[model samples]
Target: MRVIVVGAGEVGTNIAERLQDAHDVVMIDRDRERVESITYDQDVLALEGNGTSLETLEEAGLERADMVIASTDIDETNVVICGAAKAMDDAFTIARIKRTNLLRTWERSEEAFGVDFMVCTDLHAAEAIVDIAGLPGARDVDSFANGLVRMAEFDVKPTSPIAGETVAEADRYESLTFAAILRDDDVVIPEGETVIQPHDAVVVIGSEESVREFAGSLTPAPTLEQANEVVVVGGSEVGYQTARLFEAAGLEPRLLERDPDRARELAERLPQTLVLQSDATDIDFLVREHVDESDIVVAALESDEKNLLVSLLAKRIGVGRTIGVVEYGEYADLFETVGMDVAINPRLVTAEEITRFTREHRTEKLAMLEHDRAEVLEIEVDADSVLCKTRIREVMADLPEGVVIGAVTRDGELITPRGETVLEGGDHVVVFVDTEVLDEVAAAL
Candidate 1:
C-alpha cells in the first residue's frame, strides 16, 4: 500500500519505520535536516514542507496514496493535514490530536472532518495508566481490536501447577495458547518439549474464555478483582481522566488535591468520586484518609519527583498497588526501579496510537501487541485457502518463516491446537507472523 506520513517526530518516525517493511511510505517534515536524516537513515522518501499545504501533499502523490496520517506535534496542523487529505482522495485518514478539548470535539463530531480514525494520545495514555493502576498484578495487557481478544503477560509463580509442564502437555487444554515466554531479556518460542520454569514472563493469547481457563490452570492463580476503594493523588487533567475511567469501570475513587477551589470544581465535575482538598505530600493527610484501606493509589501530580515520592509513600503505607504518571520519558526507569506497578508517558502512548491508526492491512488490531512494532494476527479460514483440510503439524514446514499458529477459534470455542488439529473452514486461527511476512502468511491461510 502507498502511505504518506506527515511528521518526522518520534511518532511519525515510528509509523514510517513500521510501514516501510511492507508499504511504500513517504514521510514529510518541516525541518529539512530531519527530512534528510529520515531519508538517509531509513531509506524512505522524505519531503520537507508544511504537510497541511495541498501543494506539498500533492507533490508527495497524495492522490495515489491509500492512507495519509497526520501526526505533527501541533494539533491544529494535524487536523489541517487530515482534512486536506480527506478532501483530496477520501482515503483513510488519521489525526493525532493532543488537546483535551479537541478530543472531546473529535469524539462528538468525527464525521465532519472526514477522519477515518481519531487518536487522542493523552486519553490513550490515561486509559493505559488507569488499567495498570487498577490491575497491578498484570505485567501487561494487550487489548485486541475493540477488545474482542486480549493477550496478557504474567509471571509464572514458583508454586504454579504447570511450572514444570512441557509445552505439548500445556497445549492439551482445549483453550489457551502459550504465545511466547520472556525469560530474562530473551524471548523464547516454546516447542512441544519446552518446559515452563518459575519466574518466566509468559504471554498468553486467547479469547476471554480461553484466557480464564489458562489463568485457572496455574496453582497460584491470578484474578481480576475490583478495587473497593481507590485513591488518586493530584487533580490534574490526566489524574481526572484516569479517575473517570476507573469510575466507569465500576471502581470507587477518591481524588486528592491541594487547592480547595480546584477540588470543589473537580468534585462537581466528578460527582461519583470523593474530592479532598489536601496535599498528597502530607503524610498525615494520606494516613488520615485511611490510605491503608485503599486497594490502589495512583500518584499523578504534575511533578515527577512528587509522583514518585507519593507512590513510594503509598506503597510503604500498605497500599496494595501504586502507579505513577511521569511526563518525562527519562523518569520511566526510575519509577520501574522503585517498584511502581506502572508508569506511563503520554507522548509515547499518543505516538503508539498514531502509529497503529496510520498502518493498515497487514494485521488487524486484535493480532498486534499494544505499542509493538510487529504484530501477530488472526485470519479466518477461507474456502480457497491452502491451509484448509490440512493438519497443522503437516503444514508447519510449508508455512512462511516468522509465522506460527498460536491458537484457533471454532464455533465460538477456543483451542490451544496441536499438530494433529486439522484446519477447518470458518475457523478463526491466530497466527504470529512478522509484519514483513504478513502477506505471505495471509496467502498461505
Candidate 2:
C-alpha cells in the first residue's frame, strides 16, 4: 500500500508508524519541526507543506497514493484536506474530526466530504470509556465477530485474585482464550503452566458471556448495568458524548458543568442525564450532589491537568472507578499510574479507528493492543487459505511462535479452538499476532 498521511500530529504519526513496515508511507505537515521529527524517527518521506493545497498534494505524490488520510487537529482543515485529495485521485480517503455533527453530515451521503471513511475523535473516546465501564477490572475492551466475541485487557494488580495463578488454573471460563500476557516490554504467549504475575496486562478473547464471567472473577465490583451510578464531571464534547452513550445504555448518569449556559443546554439535550451547574473542583458542590457515592466518576474536562485533578478528587472522595479523558497520548500511562482506572486518549482512539478502516477489505476486523505491540485480527476462512479445513494441532506447526487463534465463529455460533478441532471454509477466526511477526502471520494464515 502506498499511503499519504496529512498532518504529522499524534494521530497521523501513529498511522504512519503502523503502516511504514508494510507499506510505502508519505507524511505531510506545515510544521517544519514535526516534519523533521517524523523524518528522523520513521522510515517514511516527510514533506513540510499545506496538505490542502493542490501543488502540495502533487509534490507528495498523491497521484500514486493508494490511500490518503487527513488527520489534522482542526476539523475543518482535515475535511478540506480530504476533499482536496479526493478531487485528485482514486485513493481511499479518511478524515479525522472532533465533532459528531460533521460525522453525521458525512453519513448522510455516499463519499460525503470527499472522504471514503471518517472517524470522530470525541465520540470514539467516549465510546471507549463506556466500553471500559461495562467490564469491571478491564483496562481496555474491544469487540469482534459482530460483538459475538470480545477482547479485554486487564491489568492484574498484586491483590487481584488471579494475579498469582497459572494460566491453567485461571482458564476456568468455558469459552475464553488467554491470548497474551504483556509483561513490561515483553509480549508473552502464555501456556497452561505460565504464571500470571502482578502488573501483567492479561489479554483474553472469547464469547461475551465468558469474558464477562472472567471479568467478574477478577474484581468484586459490579458491571455497569448493576452499578448504575455514574458521574460525568464536565460539559465538554467528550463528557457530553460520554453521558449520552451511558444514557443510551439504559443508565442515567449525572453531568456537572461549571458554565450555566452550557449546563442548561446539556440539560435540554440530554433528557436522561442530570445536569448540575457547579464547578467540579468545589468540594462542597460534589458532596451536596452526592458525587462521592457514585460508582464511576469520569473526568473529561477541557484540559489534561484539570481532568487529572478531578480524577484525583474523585478517588479521594471514594468513587469506585475513575476514567480520565487524556488529550495527550503520552500522559495516558501517567494518568493511570496516578490512580485513574482508565485514561482514554481521543487522538489514539481516532488513529485506531482509521487504521482499522484501512484494513477493512483484507481483514474483517482489527484491534491494536499495547500501542501496536500486537494486533487481534478477524479473518474469514476460504478454500484456498492455509487455515481452511486444517486441524488446530497440525496448523500450529506452520504458524509462527507469537500467533494465537483466539476464537472461531461459524453459522453465527462460537467455536472455541482446541488441539483436535478442525476448521472449515467460511468460518471466521479471531487471531492474535505479535507485531514483530504480523506480516509473516498474515501471509501464512
Candidate 3:
C-alpha cells in the first residue's frame, strides 16, 4: 500500500514508522529541519512541502497513494489537508482532530469534510484513561472480538501475590492467558516455568470476566464497583471527558479547576461531578478538602509539568492510584517512572488508533504495547491462513518463539486456546507477537 502522511509531527512520524515496514510511506512537512531529520533517520521518503498545496501533493505522489493521513497540530490545517487530498485522488483520507464537537459533526456525515475517517485525540485519550481505571492495576487496556475479549497490562509489584510465581502457577484463572511478560527491555514469551519478576509488565488476554478476576488476584486495590471516591484535576477536555465517563459508569467524581469561570462551566455541565475552583498545586487546599481520602486521582492539566506535580502530590497524599495525562510522548515513561501509576499521551493514542484503522483489512483489531515493543492482534482465520485447520501445538512448532495464541472466538463464543485446540476457518484468534516478528507473523496468519 502507498501511504502519504501529512505534517511530520510526533503522530505522523509514528504512523509512518508503523506502516513503512509493510507499505510504501511518504511523509510531508513544512518544517525543513523535520523533513531533513526524517530523511536521514527513517526508511521512508520525507518531502519538504505544504500538504494543503496541490503542487506539493503531486510532488509527494499523492495520486498513486492508497491512503493519506492528515496529522498536523492545528485541527483546521489537518482537515484542509485531507480535503485537498480527497479532491485530487480517490485515496482514503484520515484526519486527526481534538474537538468533540467537530467529531460529532463529522460523524453525522463522514464525507462532510472529505475525510474517510476521523480520530479524536482528546476523546480517545480520555476513553483510554477510563478503560484503565475500570480495571484494577491495569496500565493499559483494550477490547477485542466485539468486547467479548479483553487485553490488559499490569505492573507486577513486589507486594503482588503472583510477583514471584511461575507462569504455570499463575495460570490459575479459568479462561485467562498470560500473553507475554515484559521485562525491563525485553519482550519475554513465557513458558510454563517462566518466573514473573517484580516490576515486570505482564500482558494477559481472556474473557472480560476472567480478566477482571485475574486483576483482582494481582492487587488489593478496590475495583471500579467499590471505588467511591474519584478525583479529576484540571478542566481540560480530557479531564472533562474522563469525569463524564465516570458518571456514565454510575459514579459521581470530583473535578478541580483553578479558573473560576471554567469551574462554573464544568459545574453547570457536569451535574454529577463536584466542581471546585482552586489551584491543584496548593497543598493547603488539597489537604483541607481531604483529597487524601480519594481512591483515584487523575491529573489532566494543560502543562505536563503541572500534571507531573499534581500526580506526585496525589500519590504523596495516600491516593490509591494516580493517572497522569502526558502531553509529550517522551514524558509518558518519565511520569510513570517518577511514581505516577499510569501516563497516557493523547497523540500516541491517536496514532495507534489511526494505524490500526489503516490495517483493518488484514486484522480485526490491534493494540500496541510497551511503546511498540510488542503487539496484540486479532485476526480471522481463512482457508489460506496457516492457523486454519491446524492444532495450536503443531502451529506453534512451525512459528517463531515470540508468538502466543491468547484467545479464540467463533460464532460469538469464546474459546480458551490450548495445545490440543484445533482452529478452524472463521475463528477470530487474538495473538501476541513480538514487534521484531510482527510482519512475518502477520503474513503467515
Candidate 4:
C-alpha cells in the first residue's frame, strides 16, 4: 500500500519508519530539517511542504495513496488534513488527536473528521500503563481473543525460579508457550533446548490464568495489601487517565502534582483519588505524606529526567513497583537498567497502533514485543490460502522458524492448537513472529 504520513514529528516519523519496511511510505513535513533527516535516515520519500495544502497532497501522490495518516502536533490541522485527503482520494484516513475533547466530538458522530480511525497518544500510553500496572511482573502485556489469550514480558531476575532452566523444562504450563526472550539488546525466539538466563526479558503467551501463574514464578509485581494505595506522581493527561483507569478497576489511587492549580483541578475531577499538591522529587514530602506506603508508584511527569528521578526515589524508599513514563524512546532502556520495572513510551504505543492500520493484510490486532524486535499479529485467514485446509502439525517444517501460532479462534471460540489441531479457512489466528519472518508468515497464511 502507498501510505502517506503528513507529519515528521516523533509519532509520524516512527510510523513512517516502521511502515517503510513493508509499504511505500511518503512523508510530508513543512520543516526542512526534519524532511532532510527522514530522507537521509529512512527508506521513504520525504517531501517538505504544508501538509494541509492541496498542491502538497497532489505532489505526494495522494491519488495513488491507499492510506493517509495525519499526525501533526495540531489536532485541528490533522483533522483538516484528513478531511482534505478524504475529499480528493478514495483512501482510508487516520488522524492523531492529542486532546480527548476532540476525540469525544468525533466519536459522537462517526466519520465526523473524515477519519476512518483515530489514535490518541496520551490515551494509548495511559492504557498501556494501566495494563502493565494491573498485571503482576509484567513490563509489557498485550491481549488477544477478547482477553482469553495474553502475552506478557517479564524481566528475568537472578532469584527467578526458572532462571537457568531450559525452555522445555521451564515451560511446564499446559497452555503457555515461551514466545520470545530478550537478552540485552538481542531478541531470541527460544527453542526447546534454549536455556533461560538471569536478567533476560522473556515473553510468554498463553491462557490468562497460565500466564499469571508463570508471572508469579518470576519477579512479579508486589501485591497491593490495601485497597487504595497506588501512588501516581504526576497530574498530566497520562497520569490523570491512569488514575481514572485505576478507579474504574476499583483501586483508589493517590495522584501527586507539582502545580497547585493543576493539582486542585485534578482533585476536583478525580474526587476518589487523593490529589496531593507537592513535588514528588522531595523524599521528605513523600515520607511525610505516607506515599512510601503505596504498593505501586507511577511516574508520569512531563520530563523524562523527572520521571526517572521519581521512579528511583520510589525504588529507594522501597515502593513495591515503579513504572516510569519515558517520553524519548532511548530513555526506556535506561529506565530498565536503572531498576524501573516498566517504561511506557507513548510514541511507541501510538506508532504500533497506527502501523497496524497501515498493514495491507487484514490484521484484527497487532502488538510489538521486545522493543519492536518482533510483532504479534492476529490475522483472519483467507479461504484460498495454503493454511486453509491444512493441519498445523503437518506444516510445521514449512512454517518459518520465527513464527509461532499462539492461539486460534473459530466461531468466537478459543482453540488451543496442539500437534493434531487442524486449521480451517476463516480461523482467527494469533501469530507471534520475529520481525524478520513477518512477511513470510503473512504470505503463508
Candidate 5:
C-alpha cells in the first residue's frame, strides 16, 4: 500500500513509523527540521512541502497512492489536504480534525471535504475518559463487534464478586471471559485454576450487555447520580470536548479555566456545563470549589507538570478518581505511578486508532489495552486460514502463552469459546494477546 501522510508531527511520525515496514510511506511537512528528523529516524520518504498544495501532493505521488492521511495539527489544513487529495485520485482519505463541530459537518456529508473517515483526537480522548469514568473502578474500556463486544480493564476490589473466586468458580456469566490479569508487573494469562486477587488489574472481554452486568456484580453498585459529579480542569480543546461529552450524557460537568476570556466563551458555548474562571493548580481554589469532592477530576492542562500537580493534589484531597492528560508519552507511566488513576496521551491514542488500518489480518477493530501491554483485535477468519475448522482446545494449545480468544461471532451471533467449540471459516474472533506475542498470534491465525 502506498500511503502519503501529510504532516511530520508526533502523530504523523508515529503513523509513518508503524506503516513504513508494510507500506510505501511518503511524509510531507513544511518544516525542514521535522522532515529531516523523520528521515533520519524512520524508513519513510520525508518530503518538505505544503501538504495542502496540489503540486506538493503530486510530488508525493498522490495519484498512485492507496491512501492519503491528513494529520496536521490544524484541523482546517487537514480538511483542505484531504479535499485536495481526493480531487487527484480516488484514494481512501482520512482527516484528523480536532474540533467536533467541523468533524460532524464532514461526517454528515464527506462530499465537500472528500474525507472517507475522520479522527478527532479531542473527541476520542473524551469518549475514552467517559467510558472509564462512568464505570466506578474501570481504567479503560473499548468496544468491538460493532459495540456488541467490549474489552474492559479495572482493578479487582476486596468486595468484588470475582476477587476471591477461581476462574472456574467465577465462570457464571454466559458471555463474560477473563482474558488476563496484571499482578504487580506480571501479566497472567489465567486458567480455570487461577484465583483472582484483590488490587490485581483484570481484563475482561464479552458482549457489552453481559460485561456491564458482570462489572456491576463484581463491584459495589455506584451511588445514584455519582457518575454525574465530574470536575474538568483546563480550557483546551480536549478539556472542552470532555466537558461537552459529559454534559451530553446528562451530567452537568463543571469546567475550570485559568483564562477568564476562554471561560466566558465556554460558558456561552456550553450552557449545560458550569464554566469557572480560575487556575486549577491552586489547591486553595480547588478546595474552595469542592473539586476534590467530585466523583472524578480530569486534568487536561497544557503542561504535563501542571496536570501532574493538579492530579496529585486532587488525589491528596480525596477525589474518587483522578485522570490526567500526559503531554509527553514518557510521562504517562510516571503520572499513573504518582497517583493519577488514568494518564492518557492524545498522540498515542491517535496512533493506536491509525494502527487498525495497517494490520495484516481482516481486523475489523483494534485497541491497545493496559497501556499497550496487550492488544485487543477483532479479526475475521479466512476460509483458508489455519484457524478455520479447528477445535478450540487444540487452537489454545498451539497459541503462544500470552494470547487468548475471548469471543467469536458467527452469523451475527456472539459465541463464547469453550474447549470443544469448533471454529469455522467466516467467523469473526476477538483475541487478546500481549504485545510481545502479537506477531506470533497473527502468524498462527
Candidate 6:
C-alpha cells in the first residue's frame, strides 16, 4: 500500500519509519533540514513542501495512496491536509489533533468531514497518565476493549511474599495467567516449575476482577488509590486534557493558570475541577492552595524548564507524585534526574498510537507483545474458515510462519485453548506473530 505522511517532525518521522516496513511511505514537511535528515537516514520518500496544500497532495500522489496521515505539530495543518486528502479520495484519512476543544467538537460530527479517524495527542497522553495513576505500582499497562481486559507489568520487590514462589503456584490464582517474567535484561517464558525471585518483573493478563485478586496475592501489594486533591500547573491543552482525565477518574483536580480569563474558561469547561488564577511559580500561592497535601502534581506548562522547576518544587513541598509533560523528547531523561515520576511527550505518544493503528490492516486492534519485535493481534475469524473446524493444535501446525494462537474468545467468553480445543465460527482469536510474517498469518486466518 502507498501511504503519505505529513510533517517530518517526531510524530511524522516515527509513523513513516514504522509503516515503511509494510507500506510504501512518503513523508513531507516544510522544513528542508527535517526532510533531508529523514530521507538520508530512513528508507522512506521524504518531500519538502506545505502538505496542507492541494498541489502538494497531488505531487505526493494522494489519489493512489491507500492512506494519508497528517501528523503535523500544528493541529490546523493536520486537519486541513486530512480534509484535502478526503476531498480527493475517501480511502482513509487520519489527523493528529492536539486541541482538546477541536477533538470534542469534531467528535460530535466527525462523519460530516469524512474523517475516518482522529488521533488526539492530548487525550492519548492523558489516558496514559490516568492508567499509571490508577495502577500506581504498574510500570506499563495495555488494555483491550476499553479496559475490560488488561495486561500489566508489576515489579516484584524483595519484600514480596511470593518472591520465591514457582510459576505453578502463581497460576493457581483462578483468573490470572503468568504471561512472562522480566529479570534484568532477560525475559523468561515461564513454565510450571519456573521460580520467581525478588526484583523480577512479572507480566500478567486477566479481567479486572481476576487481576485485582492476583495483585492481592503478591507478598506486598502495590498501592492503588485515587487522588483526592490534584495540582496541575500550566494551562496548555495537554494540561487541561490531563485535568479532564483526572476528573473522570474521580480525582479532585485544581488547575493553576497564569491567565485569569483562560482559567475561568477552563473552570467552566471542566466544572469538576477548580481552576485557580495564579502563577505556578508563586510559592506562597502554591502553599496556600495546599500543594503539600495534593496527591499528584502535574507540570504541563509550555516550557520544559518551567515544568521541571514546578515539578521539583512540588516534590520538595511533599506531593505524593509528580508527572511532567515534556514537549521536547530529548529532555525526557532529565525528568527522572529531577524527581519527576514520569515524563510524557505527547508527540511521541501520538506517533506511536498512529503507527500502531495504520501499519497493520488485517486486525481491528494490535498490541505490542513481550518483545517489541512481535505483536499480539485480535482478528475476527470468518464463519466458514477451515481453521474454525479444526482443533487449535492442528491449526497451529498449519499456521503461517511466525504466528501462534495465544487465546480465543467466543460469544464474550475467553478461552485458553490447547491442541484438543476446537475453534468455533465467529470466534475472536488472539494470535502472537513476529513482525516478519504478520501478513501471512492474517491471510491464513
What lDDT score is found at residue 96 in candidate 1? 82
Steric clash pairs (candidate 3): none
RMSD to the true structure for each prediction, in A, is 3.7, 1.2, 1.3, 1.7, 3.4, 3.6
By lDDT, the candidates rank as 3, 2, 4, 5, 6, 1
Q: Provide TM-scores for the models.
A: 0.83, 0.98, 0.97, 0.96, 0.85, 0.84
lDDT value, candidate 3, whole model: 0.92
Q: Cα lDDT of all candidates, in order?
A: 0.74, 0.91, 0.92, 0.86, 0.85, 0.75
Pick the winner on TM-score between candidates 1 and 2.
2
Stretches > 4 Å off in candidate 6: 157-166, 182-188, 194-200, 215-226, 281-288, 359-362, 368-376, 384-387, 390-407, 416-421, 430-445
Encode model 2's per-residue lDDT on 181-277: one tens digit a residue.
Answer: 9999999999999999999999999999999999998888989999858999999999999999999999999999999999999999999999999
lDDT of 2: 0.91
The sequence of per-residue lDDT tens digits that candidate 4 reaches over residues 204-269 is 888887887787777545543333489999999999989988888788889999999999899999
Q: For candidate 5, which ten residues in a row score worst on lDDT?
A: 219-228
Best by lDDT: 3
Q: Would you list the rank order by TM-score, best first?
A: 2, 3, 4, 5, 6, 1
Compare candidates 2 and 3 on lDDT and give the better one. 3
Give the Cα error of residue 304 in candidate 5, in Å: 2.6
**Candidate 5 to truth, TM:** 0.85
Model 6 collision count? 1
lDDT of 6 by residue, 1-445 (tens): 8999998887887677667777899888999999899988999988889987889888888889988999887888888888889888866888898776777777898564566788899888877766755665565566754454666667787887668989887676554667677677665657789999998878776666666666666623233353467778888888888888877767668899999888988999898888889999888888887998887788989898899989888988888777788877778767755677767777777876776667444365666533345565666667677776789888878875555565567787767656798888777766656656766675677
Instruction: In model 5, state the lDDT of residue 283.
Output: 86
Q: Which window of 10 residues has the lowest lDDT sum in candidate 1?
A: 218-227
